[model samples]
Target: MKLLPCVYLSAKQDPTSKQNLSAAMKAGAQCHGLWVANYGNQQTNLRPWNRDQIEPANPVPCKVLIHQYAGDIANGLFDFNQINPFLENPELVIKRLILPPA
Candidate 1:
């Protein structure tokens, strides 16, 4: 199954960002997309825009919506010390896996 890049959006700074990213990737997430919504923050511009911003321009191919931003599955994977945490949550993770990029 092909997986899309993991996306992140946060108002506050997170110190565990890398750990979370690593956890997600290790859990089988393919890409890493970042979208910061800070007003007038140029640093936020450096990262890729969220799906909403790009959907109009370039749409994503997928049936279900993945909520990796909430850290719901990633956190559970890290907490459980699972090497392939994404596999553990097949119902939640794989169900959201999108089609391969064209």
Candidate 2:
């Protein structure tokens, strides 16, 4: 199955974060394997590290990931606002999603 990567930033760091995460996991997004990027530090943290400390994992299904992404997108919780323009025009976002990665 295809896989996609998505993220959501809490608006006020509230308890809803856990609920949102649980919902994503229940929807089959493999929540345990999240990769958090601390943009302030320019660092990325991956969970479930091995003894050798390597990043080895596969992304969850694209459908599941995209569903979670859309949820956050609708809630305006993403790290970037550049997508706001496309919020009302999902056709553009769908095109971007289908494009090959650079």
Candidate 3:
């Protein structure tokens, strides 16, 4: 399964904020479409703007989709060790290490 990019907006966010949507697009979201999370079954569920929001200031390289995952499935469980391998790849440029230096 390919892990496509999708923007999940909550009730707190401004639905008309182009800047926020633009950021999501620049971050590599697929299809220029956004999925509203926790929308549940409702006739008034907010939908993404129908215009193009996939344009970004900086283009990303290697537009490949990876694995799929659901936030609710994992819940509160997290394992840094498991994800460390992916982050440790030499090809990945280190932006800012949030971890405290030894």
Candidate 4:
């Protein structure tokens, strides 16, 4: 099975809800590496690597891992149309899943 990172975009102010996540499971989404992060920059004493390393791992095996790369897009998290551009590569206006390189 192929494993790819998934960007869970929640329309609500908070993270993706349990209801939504449950629905996703019924639809065959197996959530891995699940965690929550509020949008925006914050101060922390821990170095980036150390902090990231401590983030919990997914106990359940899944084809997708939830990722957060909602980089400072203007209409991001609000406009659905903006999502396509945010995910496309140059020289092509396309819709595709962007998985991290192996």
Candidate 5:
């Protein structure tokens, strides 16, 4: 099987509602990590490792690398994101998860 990065299409109720994640894996989509989305209240000067750790409402299927904490910034022009705080070495883990397999 080939190793491919996967992102969880996050939803308000169910994070994996957009696609059949399990079926995709069965069809050869390897999930190295996930990009979980969970919008928060704040919208300005957001940075990684700055905000309090806020997890998604619904349980995710795999390891999460990035968390989209806020959306509709600048009047729907941009969104905010951060590295997963739970990770021991977030920078290293993210690099490993995102880079093409060696």
Candidate 6:
């Protein structure tokens, strides 16, 4: 079972900025998935630009997989997450997370 190489984009580091992504690529990171840790709100919705905003600067395209949307849900113990629902091929995405590319 192979897992995708993922990058964690924290809110403190401005997770939504392209500069962060560029930096990750410059650092020799094979980022296939992004784990965005932004405790903005307790909503299970995909970001507005997550669907069609692909940075041409990246070698391998990376997409948001698990989003840490809310924190301290139960006495500051748990964090809420949501899979990006706006992706083109969600099944393929899931497979990519757990399986190596063909």
Which of the numbered candidates is closest to the native, going by highest lDDT?
Answer: 5
CA-lDDT, candidates in order:
0.34, 0.33, 0.30, 0.33, 0.59, 0.55
Candidate 1 segments whose C-alpha is farther than 4 A from its true place: 1-6, 40-102
- Give the Cα-based TM-score of candidate 3 against the true structure: 0.22
- What's the TM for model 5? 0.54
Model 4 misplaced stretches (Cα beyond 4 Å): 1-3, 6-16, 39-41, 47-102
Per-residue CA lDDT of model 4 for 6-72, tens digit only, reads 3343222233355555567667875532322323332322223232432223222222222233343
lDDT by residue for model 1 (42-93), tens: 2311334344422212222222123222212423421111112223454444
- Model 5 RMSD in Å is 4.9
Q: lDDT of candidate 3? A: 0.30
At residue 74, what lDDT does model 1 achieve? 27
Where does candidate 2 stray beyond 4 Å? Answer: 1-3, 10-12, 32-102
Query: Ranking under lDDT, best-scoring first?
Result: 5, 6, 1, 2, 4, 3
TM-scores for all predictions: 0.28, 0.26, 0.22, 0.30, 0.54, 0.48
**Model 6, 28: alpha-carbon shift in Å?**
5.4
Best TM-score among the predictions, by candidate number: 5
Q: Candidate 5, 5: how far from true, in Å?
A: 4.0
lDDT of 3 by residue, 1-102 (tens): 222333334323444544645555567743322332232222222233211222222323222112112222234422111112232342332222233377
Instruction: Give the per-residue lDDT of model 2 (tens digit) for 1-102.
Output: 112333433222345654656567677755312222222211122222221222112222221112111113344544422222213554545565576777
**Residue pairs in candidate 3 whose N, alpha carbon or C atoms collide under 3 angstroms:** none
Name the candidate, 1 or 2, with the larger TM-score value. 1
Model 2's TM-score against the true structure: 0.26
For each candidate in turn, give its C-alpha RMSD to the true structure in angstroms: 14.8, 13.4, 12.9, 10.6, 4.9, 6.9
lDDT of 1: 0.34
Candidate that beats the other on lDDT, 3 or 4, i.e. the better one: 4
